[model samples]
Target chain A: MVENHPSQASKFKCEVKNLNFYYGSVRVLKDINLSVFSHQVTALIGPSGCGKTTLLRCFNRMHDLYPGNRYTGEIELDKINILAPWIDPIEVRMRIGMVFQKPNPFPKSIYENVAYGLRVRGQSQRSAIDETVEQALRNAALWDEVKDRLYDLAFNLSGGQQQRLCIARALATNPEMILFDEPTSALDPIATASIEELITQLKEKVTILIVTHSMQQAARISDRTAFMYLGEIIEFDRTQTIFSDPTHRKTQDYVNGRFG
Target chain B: MTIDNLHQLHRLIARNRFWEKIFIVFGILSLLVGIITLLALLIDMTIDGLPRLSWQFFTSFPSRKYEEAGILSAWVGTCLVILVTAIAAIPIGIASGIYLEEYAKKNWLGDIIEINVTNLAGIPSIIYGLLALGLFVEQLKLGRSILTAGLTLSLLVLPIVIVTTREAIRAIPNSIREAACALGASKWQTIWDHILPYSIGSILTGIIIGLARAVGETAPLITIGALTFIAFLPDSPFKSEFPYISFNWLQAEFTVMPIQMFNWVSRPDPEFQSNAAAAGVVLVFMTLAMNAIAIFIRYRLRRRIKW
Candidate 1:
């Protein structure tokens, strides 16, 4: 059993209490209880089919797109219950952005791709959108490479550039929190290193919850780490302790690469 | 080399080469058959009608005398009827397809609608003509006019339009829709901003092909009682007065190129036969032009959007 520390609770940006999720009566998340701190990076690390990505999706209700998926439990973002029936998924999504595993850029020009989020959210001024688009690209470390050819089609860029373009697109919306579901898994090692650098810098401004398969990536960038196994969190602690001296055997075994 | 080994190798090479030559000849003959038939018909039509095609043939009204008859009113009515058909069909067809692919729930009702659409596409064009004749002309009292003919042809091609639109929408990857939704876009916004834009090129190709089919239709218009001979053009859609637009010609009498050609071919006069061949050539050219435009636009858009 993990002890709850009361002093650290109030600083949380999001809290999941007794969360249970189901896909057509088959339980996928078993009584998940966790909290993510504000302006910090928390990484969720687990093997395949352990429900890490599933739990990440619950933050923004990405599973609502399909039928027969249900969630029962309290999920609070800044003291508001995001799982309440009255809350709109679209509204929740605007407050919290998500980057998918694959780099799915819109079939449009790079400028339009970054501007799409702002444009759909009702930002119509040309000058304002232009400034925000530039800022986002710069923040994602892609402005210098693509600034000259913003009007070109997004697919014309290489894979790494496209992924960074997606990041820029998410950042343009100015969300308080961003979710990363293995954002670098599809990228090469060089691209992955650049994205890790970007993520470390991003935590200064926004809260982040990243799901990753690489244990080293979690140890490298995250301020906190949660080791999940078979739909449950086995350990949650400071990244240093989780890597060096975890309280749970499962965490120690998995971290040392004995087995996934 | 041993005598037996040389003999076996020579027989094997000779047998394979002989079969390869046979297959090559067959493939060339199959391709040539279609090209030869088309070329023969084109040459025959040119020889019979090239001299008859002139500015007067394009501008003069149909006359009782074979020498004086032209297809001016027929071609004009063809344009007017096609315009009406496009206006009525494209929106409804595209909307139905979108609703089925994006909005409709996957249940028995949806299944029935889908199955029925496929079945409707396979039904004969003459059946749709009879349906339109009964519904639009007789029951709705639209009268045997341009509007009635347009409505009938729209029905004839509606199935084709719906089927093709659905195919185009299906070709889009689901990831694009999910990406749009993840960006905080609502259902309407996702469809309008992402789904519609990416699939629009394909939808347009389908619509143009459908419209081409509509233009070539003869039975539906005939069933709806379109006139065989029309000497006067319909009124202009533009007005010099207040409102500045008019649809007064929709309810007026009309005749199209195919009907005019049919009437000419049924005549006993050799000159009228030549006129019929000329009209057929023009109709074929129009269909080919529309198809060429569709192919060009589809190619351009496919290159632009790699996804």
Candidate 2:
């Protein structure tokens, strides 16, 4: 049994209740229940193939893109079940943004990359797009580096800059929540630290759900952490508690680097 | 470790190196065979036809006098037919390719369609000429005009364009598609915004190469009954009247470079054989120009995009 935090004051931004996910009839995530607090960073940490990424993807209905992927139960955002069949996945995606594992910037200019989401949403005013693009790039901590070359191809940027460009792309849409899937795994230590710092700062504006292979990353940035093993959450608690005083043996062993 | 072991290893390495040298020589020889043959033919054609290539030769029409006969009618017909072919083939071929690659579900029916499309490229070009004869010429009652010839060649190269377009689209990374979709773009939006822009360069390269093949095609045009001798050009695609553009050129009788060359070569006069050689050189140059354009576009686009 997982105990509630002593202070239950934070409002729930999203709540996953009895959520199950499957890939072509093979269950990958089993009965995941968790709460994501508003304006807080929640990190999902587990060994590879433990369904952490799958669970993260379910929040925005990313699984809907592929055939034969199924989801059951509820992923309620602000008390509304987004997993309902009638709810268009496009609507769900519009409200939530995602940064992929590697920097997958479009083969376009940096400004266009940041402006793409806005363009998709039909924000056609030139001034509004420029302002939002500037603000988003600033929020991603990339404005100073790339402002002079806004029209330069995104591929011209370094790996870290490209990742930030992708983040800016997601941010330009003004999504309520952002999901990062191992956003810094492809970067060096310096780039990774910058991105980690950016995520910590971003929580004041948008709810963040990130999946990371590194427990240290979750420990440093996440307000709350969920340690998953073999398709189930072994423990979910405040980041400190999960790292220092985990309730489950598997969580304790996994967090301590004894075994995965 | 041991001197004897070292000697054996050296001998083995030497033997392998000898085989590598032999293979390199063989590869170069194989490459030279095709290059030398082409060069020899080009040189022979130049020798036979260089004196015949004059401004008047390009500007004048075919005549009984060998020296007076030019390729004005043939080249104009070729250009008009190619224009029609490009107009007919590019859109239909590209749209079909996009539909198959992006919209079609990966099922048994899709598999069958895919196999048939691949097989279409291998079918004889003459078969396409026959189909065009039945469909465009006889059934539609269109004569052996530029439109009929163009449509015939279009049918012959449509498979090439479709196959190449699919290959180009398939080359795009899945991540690019996901990024577009993740940003709330609908399927059509994703395709229009990302897929088409990225793949346009390769699709064009494919289209031009297909057209180059179409340019050199003699069998299909002949099979569809293109004229062997013509003294007049097709109607100008532009007009001085209202609307300014004309479709009359499409319905005008035509003859292309290859057909002209074939007609000259079959004539009893040796001077006409020289005319055939000159026409052959110009035809080869036209094909080369199209390929060069394709290569240039591919290079430009490749430099702009990576991964």
DockQ values, each candidate: 0.75, 0.81
What fraction of the true interface does each of the listed models get right, in terms of native contacts kept? 0.74, 0.79
TM-score, every prediction:
0.93, 0.95
Interface RMSD in Å per candidate, to 1 decimal? 0.9, 0.6
Return the top candidate by TM-score: 2
- The global C-alpha lDDT for each of the candidates, from Candidate 1 onward, is 0.89, 0.91
How would the docking of model 1 be graded?
medium
lDDT per residue as tens, model 2, A43-136: 9999989999899889889898888999998999988899999999999999999999999999999999999999999899999999999999
lDDT of 1 by residue, A79-111 (tens): 999999899999999899888898899989999
Q: Which pairs clash in model 1?
A: none
- Clash total of candidate 1: 0
Compared with the true structure, model 1 gives a TM-score of: 0.93
Q: What is the lDDT of residue A245 in candidate 1?
A: 99
Regions of model 1 farther than 4 Å from truth: A1-9, B1-24
Off by over 4 Å in 2: A1-10, B1-25
